[model samples]
Structures are given as C-alpha cells and as structure tokens.
Target chain A: MEKKDTFIKAIQENERLIFKVASFYTDSKDDRDDLVQDIIYNLWKSFDTFQQRSSFSTWMYRVAMNVAILHLKQRKRKVPAVPIDLGALNFAETGFDGNEEKLQVLRKLMNDLNLFDKGILMLYLEDKSHTEIAEIIGISKSNVGTKLSRIKQKLRQQVNNQNQKTAWN
Target chain B: MELDELKSNWENSNNRPANQNSLTAKMIDQMIQTKYDAKLNKIRYPEIGGGLVCAIAIVFIACNFNQLDTAVTRSTGAIAILLLILLPILSFLSLSKLNFESAVSESHVQVLQQFAIDRLRFQRYQKMNVTLCYLLMVAIIILLPKFFYGKDLVINKAFWTFAFSFGYIFLLVFSRLMSRYYGRSLNQAEELIREIKETTANS
Candidate 1:
C-alpha cells in the first residue's frame, strides 16, 4: 500500500512533464491533453519495469516522448473536425491575454517547425544544457549544439522579418 | 529578439492548458482508458487483420480447387500449396528474428512503428500481386475458348485473342491508375512513420 501511494504521488508530482512534452508535440489543446494522458497511462503500465538505472524523471521523459511521437503519427491519418486557429488561443478568453502578441508570434514559429526541431527547441527553451538536450533527444551533444545554433539564427531572422513587416504596417 | 528572450517568452507564457478543471480531468481519464485498451488489443492480437485474411483465403481456395479448369487448377493448386507451406515457415522465421519485448520496450516504440510501416508496404505489394494475377486469369479465360473451337469458331482466334489482350492491357492500366490513387495515402502513412522515427531517433 505504501509503495502504491508513493508511486501515485510521484506521478501526480511529475504530471507537468506530460503536459509540457505533449504541448511541444501537438498544436491542438485537446490533442496535447490526450497525448499527456497516453504518456501517463503508458508510464503506469510500464511502472513495474522502472529500474533504478536512471532517475524516475528520466524514465518518465523517455516514455512521454515515445507516446507523443506515436500519437502524432496516428493523428496524421485522421482529418481534423475543426481547424485549429493558433490566433484564437491568444485572445483574452483563452487565458493568454497578457502577452498575447508575443505568445502568438512564438506559437506561429513553433508551429512551423517539424517534429524533431520542435522537440529540440522545446527542451532548449526549458533551459536544458546541450548535454541534457542530447540525452532527451537521443542525439550527439555536438549535433544538438549545431542544430541549436542554426535554429536560433533562423528564429532571429523570423523575428526580424516580423518586426519589419509590422513597421511597414 | 534574442534567443534568450524568445525562450523566456515561451517558458513564461500562460498559453499552456490549464491543469485544474473537471473537463481536463475527464479528458485525461478518457485518453488513459483509450490508450490502455489499445495496448491490450495490441498484446492480445499482435498480428494485423491482413494475416487473418490470408489464412482464410488459403482455406477458401483449398476448398474450391475443383471448380477451376485443369491447367489453372493445377497451377493454382501448386502455388497455393507452396504458399500454405511457406506462410507458417516464413512467419516463424520472422518471429524468431523479432525481439518482441524489446520492440515494444518503452524506449523503442519508434522501432515498432517502422515495423508497422514495413508491414503496410508488404500488404500493398500483396494487393498489387493479387490484382495483376486476377487480370491475367480473366484474359486467359476469355482466350481459352478461341483455341478449342479452332477454324469452326465464329470469331477468329487471333481476333478474340487480340481483343482479350487489349482488355487485359486496359485492366492493367486501370490497376495502375487505382494503385496510384491509393499510393498517395500510402505515401502519407510512410511519411508519418518517417516523422516518428526521425523525431524519436533524434530525441
């Protein structure tokens, strides 16, 4: 009973990992939440095999990423019932009222990225080191460094372009 | 903006889903239930429905061999017999090569997705083979009468042979057209698999 309680408590504590990882992969709010649930469910199912080779968080992240990627692949097969408008999430009604413009621009840029780029960018944004990012992304540290350098340059150019277009307006 | 600023903006933003609501809880619950059920279904029946259909087809063909003409019957019987003997052997070979538990291990879903894509390609090839074989059989059936009736046949054997050949050619063209139509979807599925593999591998 104590072990079960501890496991459940750990899950509840680390639940935010699911949301963050899921949001990185999925654009739609519903799909993001669904992906999070799938990740958690997978973690629970595989809980018995959770060896102490790595920290629980590391294990959880691995499971979360696997589920998110798989879910994204499955999602491609179905047509969306309603098109998601990234702009709509920026409105006051959606709880993003304070920094709507910045959030909207960032969301647009993130949405433009392919899945692998998005995963790397998300981890980078979360302040993970290149080494840690490589572990999370299963890439070499040098590869992560090069990719991040290019990604940063691309993002800077995009922001500049957006600013210039705004100035013209 | 600087990279740090952009990263900060994303991190500090409140655009993320609110975690504390009944609706959110219910949605998460549903997702968990659905994933659990899917996992159960996968474990209970790892083989896809295509394998089951192939098994049934072998049984049906075996039971209907007498209905076909002697030459076709003999050729098909030989082929069917070969397939029946080969299927289990091939399946066992592949199964032996598979590391089933490792393929589905928490760290290796991407590998499993690749396997699924390969299976889909094999299924598509099978469908194309069946289509081509059927078209050929239809042509053979139409032309066989011409050879038997010999000069007494109202229509010339060569004429009917050419006609059947033209029809067969048209069927082949049609099959290609249909395959192209379905090919777009298969391409999309393949792309999804590639995306999953690349993402997981990179991560």
Candidate 2:
C-alpha cells in the first residue's frame, strides 16, 4: 500500500516526461497510451530495485527511455510517432529568434533520426545536462558531447538542404 | 532559423506540458490491471499449452510403450516419446526469447544487444519447432490408436495413403499460415534493428 502510493506519486510527478519519451517512440495516441501503461507497469515492477543512490528524475528518465525502446521492439513502426508540442519550445531567445517554421523543420528532421540520436535530441531539448543525458543514455559524458555535436551538425546540414529545396520550390 | 538559434529558444523556454493526457488515479489503476503481456504475443500461451499437452503424452508413452506387443509398434512408441519431449522444448525456447519484462532493467545498449541475440534465438527455435512438428504429428497419429484402441494406423495401407496425402497438405498450409503470422514479429524486430544501425551509422 505504501509502496503503491510512493510509486504512483513518482509517476504522477513525472508523467509529462513519460509522455514526451513515449511520443519519441510511438506516434499514435493508442500506441502512446499502451507504451505509457507498459512504462508505468515496468516502473512499478522494478520499483523495488530503484534506490536513492541517484536522483529520482534521472533514474526515472533511464527507465522511461528504455521502456520506449523495448516498446518499439514489440510493435515496430516505419516512422516513429512524434507529437511535437509546438508550444513546448520558447522562440524568444537571444541571437536569432526561432519561429514555428523552424520548430516544424526540427520536428521533421527528428523524424529521420535513429532512436539513439532522437533520444539525445529530446534530452538536449529538455535541457538535461551532459552528465544526466549520458547517465540516462548509458553513454559516457564525453560520448554524449560528441554525439550531440554530431547530431546538431547533421540536423543543421539537413535543415540547410531542406531550406534550399524549399527556396527552389 | 539556425539550429543554434532554436537551441537558445528551447533552452530559454519555461517547462510546458508535453502531453495533454493527465495521470488520473483511475487511469493508473486501469494500467496496473491491464495484463496485456498474454495479449501481445498471440503465440505464447498456445505454445505453452501445446507443450503441456506434449508433456502429458510424453509421460503416457513412457508408461505404456512397454505394453505394446510388436517390435515395430514399440519402436514407433519410443519415437513418439522422443518427439513429444522435443516439441515442448522447442516451443518453450521460442517463447522464452520474448520476455520483455526480464530485460527492463538492462541499459539501452544492453537491451538492443540482447534483443538481437534473442531474435536470432527465437527464429532458430521457430525453425526447430516447424521442422519437428511434422514428426510430432506423425508420432501422435501412430501412437493414439495403439494407446486408446490397441490398433496401429501405420499398418493400414489405405489409411496411411490418405493420411499422408491429407495430413501433408494440411500441415503445409498450417505451417505456412503460422510462419507468415509469426513473421510479423520477426519483421518488426528487424526493422528496428536496421533503422538503429542506419541512424547510428551517421554518428
């Protein structure tokens, strides 16, 4: 009973994070719902193993991400279902302002990323630190740095080529 | 906007709700109750059930094989016992490869690596199952009449001819249909593996 309450409380607190992770893997609402259920179930099942050694959010992120990976294996999809929240990103930052079109472009490019890189991008967008991302992704912190740069460069190149195509049209 | 520009915006933005779905207590209870593991793989329970039936037949044959009179009938009974043992082992091997819950705590890389191994093992188990099922069926056909009515169907020429023709066709069709159905799972696994390889290749 106590166990259930704590687990449920943790899930409620991080449900949005779970949804974002689920969206990265599952496109449809039904699939997302199923994936969420599986994640929660697995979390509850493995809750006993979860210790206070790490931050609860970091541990939860690892479990959520892995569940999504395992979920995709059960029912493979050609295109991962990403329900990008347009309102999720703020466009009023310094340097150059980003608009909805840019968010759409980033979202479209994300569709082309592999599960690992897509996961990195999602983590990056969430502003998770290099250490946290590495811990969650099971890669070294330096590897996370390398991969982020590679992914960003790749995204930039793809966006450029896409913009060129758009201009041509 | 440049990727760097977008990064700034995303970094500067406050935490917004990513999914509109709320985590209601009712929803939590429903999720906890949804035991869809049995539902996900349509083949798992059927395979287990088949294995149990084979196990019963195995015990029955072990006890009764000595009571048969002829050498040929006794040899057939021995062979049937062997097949019954093999049948369940193969099916269980295949089913065990798909235990998603067991790998939940494994890291992402470990999970993928394990999945790759499991998928290969699964296909191998499936092949073994499909091949040995023919023998299992034949053994069951030969042994059932002996155990139940003290008769041998293999000795009857007409029955052998008709049974071979019809059973061969039926098993062929059944195996083909099942292979196609189960192949969806294999294909889905392969698709994820291939995409992962392709995307990771860029990095």
Candidate 3:
C-alpha cells in the first residue's frame, strides 16, 4: 500500500514532465498519449533500481525520451499508410485561437527542428536552465549554450520567413 | 515582443489536455504485470536452446560410446560438448534478463546507453555462435581417426574426407551468413537511434 501510494504520488507530481516530453516527440494527442503510457511503463519497470542518486525528474525525462525514440523506431518499421489527425484537438481549449493557418505554420516549424533541439527548446520553454538542460540532454554546459543560441536564431528566422510570406499574401 | 514573452505566449496559447492521471496509473499497473509475468516465466521453464543442446549432446555421446572405449575419454567428450552448448545458452539467458525499464526510470540518458549495450551483446552472441561452430568441427575432427580405422565403417575414406572438408566450408559459410544477418539488424537499430538524435537536436 505504501509502495502504491508513493508510485501514484510520483506519477501525479511528474505528470506534466511526461506530457511535455511526449508532446515534443509527437504532434497528435493519440501519439502523445501512447508515448506517455510507454514512459510510465518504463518508469514502473525501473522503480526497483532507483538508487536515489539523481533527481526523480531527471530520471523520468530519460525514460520518456527513450520510450519516445523506441516508439518512432517501431512506427518506422510498421510503416502505416494513414497519417494521424490532429484537427480535432481544440487549440482554443489550450487557449490558442482555432486558426487553421497559424496552427499549420506552427506545426511545420516544429517539425523542421531535430528531435534533440526540440527537446532542448521544449525544456527551455518550460523554463529549465542551461545546466538542467545539459544534465537532461547529456551534453556539456557550453554546448547547451551554443545550441540554445543557434536554435533561437533558427526559430526567429523561420518565424520571420512565415511572417513575410503572410504579409506578401 | 521580447523573446521570453513570445515563448511564454506560445506556451500559454497552446492549451493541451490536462495530464491524464488515471491513464498513468493504469500504465504502471500494466508494467508491473508484465514484469511479474516475465520473472515467473524465467523461473518456471528451462531455456529452449539450453534444453535442445543438452538433448543433442546426450544423443551424440550415447551413439559414440562403443567408439569411445575409454571411460575417461567418453566422459571428457560429453563434458566438453555440454560446456560448449551451455556457454552460449547461459550468456543468452543472462542478456535477456537485463532490466531496460529500470534504466529508463533512472535517467533519460540511460535509454541510449542501454541500446548501445544491447548492440554489444548481439555482437558477442555472434562471436559465441562462430566459436561454437569451430568447437563442433574440432570434435568431428577428433572422431575422424576412429572412423577411418574401422574397416566396417559405413562410409568410404574418400567420402569421409570430402565430408570433413565440406563441413569446415559449411561452418565458414554459416558464420558469414549469421554475421551478416546480425550486422543488418544492428545497423537498423543504430539508424533508428541516429534518426531520434537528429530529430531531437533539430526540433
């Protein structure tokens, strides 16, 4: 009973971390849900070996990343012909206007970035610092700084390009 | 707008669903069940390969008892074959029991680390298979002299010699084929990892 409670508490506390990581890896709600489930499953399996050497969140992030990566690999192998529909998810419920055009542009830009950069930027947006990001990503602190700087510049360019095209129209 | 404001606005504007608490609980339950099943299965049954190899060694030794007149030589042959068969099976079982899930919960970084370890294990298995084939060939070679000396041995000397040579060639071909198969699988796994890395780095 104590173990179950602790496990449930851990899940409740880290739920956002799982969801955010899943969202970065997958665009659709269904995929995000699957990724989150996989991460949770992985975490449960690893529960006994948790030595308390590192923070729980850091460990959870690693598990989430792994599950997401494996899911992508399996998807590639299976090669489903139909694409998932993200249209039904109300951006408005999340507070974004239900503007198809803007949403389409945002989705495209998100897809343009690589998985690692996406993860970094997602953590950044969640307000994780260079040191924390570096710890999560298994990179040097300086590398994180450089990568974050470059990522921001790339994002700015993409947004500017989109804005210019919109204005021209 | 400032960069921080823009990021905050983007984050605020993208209202995703509230994290599903119930689903997370269910997933944990599923994981526990799976782990329990795996453990029970391991405890209850002998490994398929280990059992098969033991049976084969017993049959081989039983058939060749008359030829191996000396008890010491016969016992040594049986023990050698058993060890050769057992080594790969034990190694495989140990590798199979590795806890990938625990590593994941420990840290996100350990995911890739685990995968790299898995690839190494596959390589080791390939080497073990090749070694086992060689050991079998050596056993056959040792037994060849007894067959050659027996006038009533079913096969002719020419046929025996040809078969021995062909067996060595067959081992080489088999090793090459198995290596290629494992190499392709490893390459595919690596490619998938690389793709994930690239996607994460860029996104």
Full candidate order by lDDT, most accurate first: 2, 3, 1
Instruction: Encode model 2's per-residue lDDT on B119-189: one tens digit a residue.
Output: 76778687777777777677678778888998777779998899889998988898898789778767656
lDDT by residue (tens digit), candidate 3, B56-131:
7667666765776555445546655675566657555544624544445433434554565465565667577567
- Could you give candidate 1's per-residue lDDT for residues A1-169 as a string of tens digits? 5665566667666666666777777766667655655666667667777787767876777667766666654564322222223223232122234877776777778776555566678778878888777665566778788778877887877888888999999
Q: Which residue pairs in candidate 2 have backbone atoms (N, alpha carbon, C) closer than 3 angstroms, thus clashing?
A: A27-A81
- Candidate 1 local distance difference test against the native: 0.59
Q: Once superposed on the true structure, which residue ranges of model 1 sit more than 4 Å away at CA?
A: A27-30, A48-55, A73-114, A153-169, B1-9, B15-38, B42-60, B70-203
By TM-score, the better pick of 1 and 3 is 1
The candidate 1 chain B region of ten consecutive residues with least summed lDDT is B146-155
Candidate 3 deviant stretches above 4 angstroms? A1-6, A9-38, A41-57, A66-129, A145-169, B1-49, B59-64, B68-90, B93-111, B134-155, B183-203
Best by lDDT: 2
TM-score of chain B of each: 0.40, 0.63, 0.53
For each candidate in the order shown, give its overall lDDT on alpha carbons: 0.59, 0.69, 0.61
Determine the iRMS, in angstroms, of model 2.
7.9
